[model samples]
Target: MAFFTRLFRPARASERRFSELVGPHIETMYRMAWHWTRNTHDAEDLVQDVLIRIVNRLDELEAADKPQPWLIRVLYYRYVDLYRRRQRSPVLPAEDCAETGFAAEAESSVMDKPDRLALAAQLERALTSLSDDHRDVVLMHDLEGFTTAEIAGVFGISEGTVKSRLHRAREKLKGKLHGSF
Candidate 1:
C-alpha cells in the first residue's frame, strides 16, 4: 500500500493547495454566478463547474497577483460557454426568475419596509432589461465594487471601453427606473 500512497500524495497536496487558494473567492464566485444565472441551482452549478475546471490549474492561480479577477474571468467564460450551449440547443426553458428574489436577498435585513421591497423589485426589473454585456459591467463595477480596470482586464477590453459600457448601462437603468419612482 505504500506504493499507492506515494502515487496519490501529489494529488492530495494539490487538493489541499486548491482549497486554500480557492476558499477565499468562493463567495465572490457565487455572487457573480448568481448574477449571471439568476437561479440558485444554476448559480451553484456554475460555480462548481468553474472550480472543477480550475482544479488542475492551481499553479497559475497561485502565481497570480490578485486571484479574484482571474477567477471571475474564468467564471465569466464558463457562463458564456454555457450560454452559447443553451443557445444552440434549447433543452430547458429559461426560469421565470422572481423579480423580487434578487432584491429580497440583498435587502433581507430591511424586509419590513414595503418601499424597500418595491424599489428592489423595480431595480431587478431594470437590471434584467439591460443587455448582457452592460448588465455584467454594471454588476461588477457598481455592485460588486470591482474597478473598471479590473473589469476591462477580465473582458479583454480597454478601460475606456469599460467606462463607456458602465456609463451606458447606468443610463439605461436610470431611464427604465425614471417612470417607476
Candidate 2:
C-alpha cells in the first residue's frame, strides 16, 4: 500500500501542475485548433489530443521560456500527423465537408457586403489550392502574425525556406485571384 501510494502521488501532482499551466490557455488552443480544422468538433478533438499528449511532458512544459509557442508547436505537429493520416485513409477530405458557417458568423456588416464576401470566398478557395506547406506558412505569417523565424522554428526549417514558401504561396494566390481584384 505504501509503494502504491508513493507511485501515484507524483502522477497526481504532475497532473495538477499540467492543469495549472494549461488551463488558462485552453481557449487559445481551441482558437488555433479551430483555425486549422475549421470545424468545431474536430477542433475540440485536436485540442484534447494535444492536451493528452503533453500531460506527460509536464517537466518540459514547465521549463519552457514561452509556453504558448511550445504549445502551438505541439499542436502543429499533431495537426500534421492527423492530416497525413486522413490522407492515407479512404475518407472524405476536410475540404469536401460542408461549411461550418464560420464565415456567416463573421461580423454581420462584413457578411452583408456581397463583394467583400465573394472576395473572401475566392481567397479561401485559393488558399485551399496551395500545398499544405505553402498554406501553413501563409496562414502562420500573413494571417496569424507569427514571425518567419518563429514559423521556421515550429516547422523545423530554415527561415529562408519559410520566407520562400510564403512568397511562393502569395504568388500562387495572386495567380488564382488575378481577375478577382
Which number leads on lDDT? 1
lDDT by residue for model 1 over 46-159, one digit each (tens)?
A: 988888799889889999888899999999999999988988995876675563456768577668887887888899889989998999999999888899989998999999
Q: Candidate 2: misplaced stretches above 4 Å?
A: 1-28, 87-96, 100-109
Global fold similarity of model 2 (TM-score): 0.73
TM-score of 1: 0.83
- TM-scores of the candidates in the order shown: 0.83, 0.73
* Least well predicted 10-residue stretch by lDDT in candidate 1: 1-10
- Candidate 2 C-alpha lDDT tens digits along 1-181: 2312232233577676876777666766676777788787788789878877987898899998767768889998999899889879987754626554445445366866888777667777788889988988887788667889888888899999999999999999999999777
Q: Any runs in candidate 1 off by more than 4 Å, and if so which? A: 1-13, 93-100, 104-109
